[model samples]
Target: MKQRGFSRRSFLQLTAGALGASLLAACGSSEASQPTQTGSGGGGAQPTTASGSPAPAVITGVTLRVVGTGVTLLEPIREQAEKDLGIKLEYDVNDGPAAQQKAATQPQSWDLYDQWFNSVKIVWGSGNAAPIDINRIQEWDKISPMPKEGKLTPEAKEGDGDAPYRILYVQPDNTLGSIPTEQISMLPLTFNVDSFGYRSDLVDEEDVDSWAILFNPKYKGKIGLYSDPSTGLMDLALGAQAAGLATFQNIGNMTREEIDTIMEILIEQKRAGQFRAFWNSFDESVNLMASGEVVVESMWSPAVTALQVRDVPVVYASPKEGYRGWYGGMMLNKNASDKVLDACYEYLNWWLNGWAGAVVARQGYYFCIPENVKRHLSQADWDYWYDGKPAAEDLLDPFGSVVAKAGSVRDGGDLVTRVSNIAVWNSVMDEHQYLVTKWNEFLAS
Candidate 1:
């Protein structure tokens, strides 16, 4: 769903002959686009003039290869990064699991890895990720304390399960911990609170205000679920608890018995046809919802906006239980050359800079350095997106598609309201391998 907000009508508009290509392109998966280089060729740095005029662009003839999902590897970012930093960028975009697997096992393939904080454990454990020196990041201090202290403010509720701060800093013993340190696993960049999206016109809003909606027999054959083991289990766990089906001492780190219990419940639901489909890609989720096949499902911010752009009457729910949270950032590859690392740093700096942040902000992602992101956004944009104020005019996505009509207010209110309400974050459990085997059994059921 990178640039596609295809509705059922839009989906059918394509010729039958072109359906395969169209679907593939809309998915934005590895096959949708190939790895390509962007940026003009050049090399050299310009020193400041005696008159104090701005220095010219520094062109580093380095082609830093980056591996990540379509979430952050959009074309606009690649073009803008190259334009701003004067370094070539080769993006290898993969889906979530593929990207993480490549980052963990193939450090020699990429210079930088752009992924969520939850992935740091596996990538760092693989010894393929290098620690990011906070001293080198220009806006490190300007980032919000949530990624450093586990809370946006002192009073904010810090959710469990691999919170960004928990795996943030690099300890003196070369391990990741929450304690403050000069080095880190990943440089926090974008984050958002997630919840399910429902067809407002089809379902009663009152009946879908909790994660339990996913387990409700009322919507049995119309429910959708993400297929990723990490997030899908978390969402289900939350729902299972909310629905009085199960409980865990630590929802973040469930015991083997707890895993068995949840899997049993899921398998039972699957056998009963409680799920319409399990989608693994953004396009699949959007298609399922926009086609009215699934009335409610776990969804991302961009996916909701995509549905809105298609005029599908979908609503992003502010679940009473709270939202699922995730934060993403840049991690250097351990095998990158010094030159490649330097170029990677330049690209990283450009991400926190105003332009890239604003581009993503339009799609409902909040950058780490709000100050810089604010600079690049207009008053109305900042108010609607960050301040949670009513929109004075229609709001368009980064691709210039109208997503919100005038007077519309963002769901979940402002940034603080959303982040503070996070109930849990995506996680990699201690028994992740065992969990995977059971997850597969449920899928097969």
Candidate 2:
């Protein structure tokens, strides 16, 4: 029997890659885009379940425009939501910088914004992060208190995932407060702790765990790096520090001096042909690895999984310096109408209905509500991805396609085990413009 709010058939049919994806289609796997994966619910009649039950309902005339990147995990679920709830999940996907610009200048372009937490600060600067009342979100109580309270462990602050105090709980006047309140900044979606990945078949496992391997002169010109300043900068910072070229007081919020030092090392590497290519999206990262042009690169988990599934032998490294983490989530547009606001709340609640979380787990992400998501997955599925157990059988993605072979074990172990060890979250520091400028120069150099 299917759950009432989400039918088994109406649930998402797509899977994910590790880390985040751009808001465009770029598949790293050999079968990145199969004809069978084409039932995306962009424009279709409300679908029916095997039992002939009516799909769930939303306000007939209303369509919630969701803005996000082109991540595949959301495809099946987005299709299912439009079919089951009978509302259009219109998307306006964009790359990292373009998406941030959209929030700053085009708040009304979309009713909901789905992006990373780091991007929220930029959106909030433009007054686009509408305060979402906790009362309206059905999952408010069920959300792990860690988000509101702001610390998963004594060392790791809420910044690693949800730092509610930073933006949550706005007053009627829209001024922010530090305490947890009835209103939240955004709905914490999915996140993961990540590090660079390499071709284990090429790089010895003993040389893979440390970040220094990225800057090793031996592999220079055969490495890939992220083009995005935030993620890519952290990777370089870790490499620079690990190689003893430079050390920072706080790499997350690097000072101008620290930035220059980091850039100098990275620029030196770039000029020396240390990097094969710079990737701006997850697909590019996967393609670079699959092409065998670059033997090592910073990567997303899904990319690693994608390569391994193809027998490419990629490994997502758990660096000795610690993981660079990120959280992707949803925020209401500040200028939406009451009707749109209500519809948006329904949509947020719908995510917590468990189906979306299950789809996310397949690609190596940890959902805000894992228990709710666990209900939709098999014991074997959960055991392999979440519990770090060996796959009892071939593990399938949300599309019911084999992603992991039998006897394969997850790389970093369980969700709790991975997230609790995060060293920093993706962030836009005080000197973002300077950092971006340096990043661009490094790429062009």
Candidate 3:
């Protein structure tokens, strides 16, 4: 009755440790803490700017504890916020799901949150998420309509990152809903679609073009998977359809029966020694790719970038079955004190101002406000990242490290070309607890 004694809680307990990883797949510490101090600035909304107009008041002297993955704690963005906005940002960067769990269970653990848009059901379902007034965010109007309407350009309308038009915009009652209201449930940030990557030199380039390559018998024990219950499972679901092992009603929202089929196939593959190891951290993924232990694996964009920098000869694949996509945003904690609530609002506005978006975009993410971020970038960067042109010069990452060679090109091409191919969005699904348990079992097996 319960699908072969796979009790709901049995294996998913493996996720209690949950192998915390950033949404961007950047390397993060087990535990990291940073302090924000007041800088030389006046008491106005636009402290860093020369504008003397009094618009909205930003509170000073309180540290806003943000519970997020390491990508959300990008040092450049953090330092800029402290210097410009006159507010302190102290992030509790951990695994993505752990941040969700904390938001759900411990409502007051942090003042703000940085998470994937898919976690809305879990985070808001926990009733800890508070509404962010649309009026408070200065750049609200500046946000590209791509996030609200799921259209990167005027003609292409399916979506850029997952279901942006679906998950954003909170309802009047402070609940997550589709239609744009004066109050958005969360402030949309950066996102990108993802697919597996492999060592092009190791695998036949001709055979590496489909999701089926992940399950091909020839590469048995040569592949690895990220140990995330959500994205990993969705990728397996897509791979199943591609490999002719199974099908799903909706790969994005898999039913219990669909999940069982996926797990059964995974168990079969496990028995055949198809997997070498499961990656729990971005650094581990880099190690796996660089060392050539696992020739192909489910990979994040940033991980692929990291690998390419090491001269690993890795290429992120464009699967025929399409990509498993994901997006992220920041949310306000409902329990935040009024004293710090305004400060939180200021922080939210800062995210949309373009500096933060520019930082992550260097690692392959696209922001909701591309224009603002473009201001912080060169025409060469905009051309390479958006227009599909070759890089004009060696590209530097946010920290001034050369990550791209001169004349080099971004793999996924222009924004529209990449986002248009998304097959499914990452999701927690209806049976999160049960699937996590089953995932844990698969890992153990």
Best by TM-score: 1
> What TM-score goes with each of the models?
0.86, 0.83, 0.85
Candidate 2 per-residue lDDT, tens place, 361-419, comes to 88777777677677767899889888889999988876777888899888888766676
| Location of the lowest summed lDDT over 10 successive residues in candidate 3 | 31-40
Question: What range of 10 consecutive residues in model 2 has the weakest lDDT sum?
Answer: 31-40
Q: Indicate the worst ten consecutive residues by lDDT in candidate 1.
A: 31-40
| Model 1 pairs in collision | none
> Could you give the candidate ranking by TM-score, starting with the highest?
1, 3, 2
Score each candidate by Cα lDDT.
0.76, 0.68, 0.72
- lDDT leaderboard ranking: 1, 3, 2
| RMSD values, in order shown | 10.5, 10.2, 7.0
Give lDDT tens digits, candidate 1, residues 368-415.
878777767888899989999989898887778886778877888999
Q: In angstroms, what RMSD does candidate 1 have relative to the true structure?
A: 10.5
Q: Could you say which candidate leads in lDDT?
A: 1
Kindly report which residue stretches of model 2 are placed more than 4 angstroms away from their true locations once superposed. Answer: 1-58, 153-165, 168-178
TM-score of 1: 0.86
lDDT of 3 by residue, 1-445 (tens): 0111111233233223232222222232220011121222234333233111123354667788888887767777778777666678887887776677676667768988898877766566556777777776766766777667666676653522236556566654544446667766678888888899999899998877788888898889899887777788877777878889998877876777877889999998998899887888898889998998999999988789788877888888888777777778888888886758877876776666677777788877888877777777788877877777888988888878877777777777888888777788776565666677687678768
Better of 2 and 3 by lDDT: 3
Clashes of each: 0, 8, 6
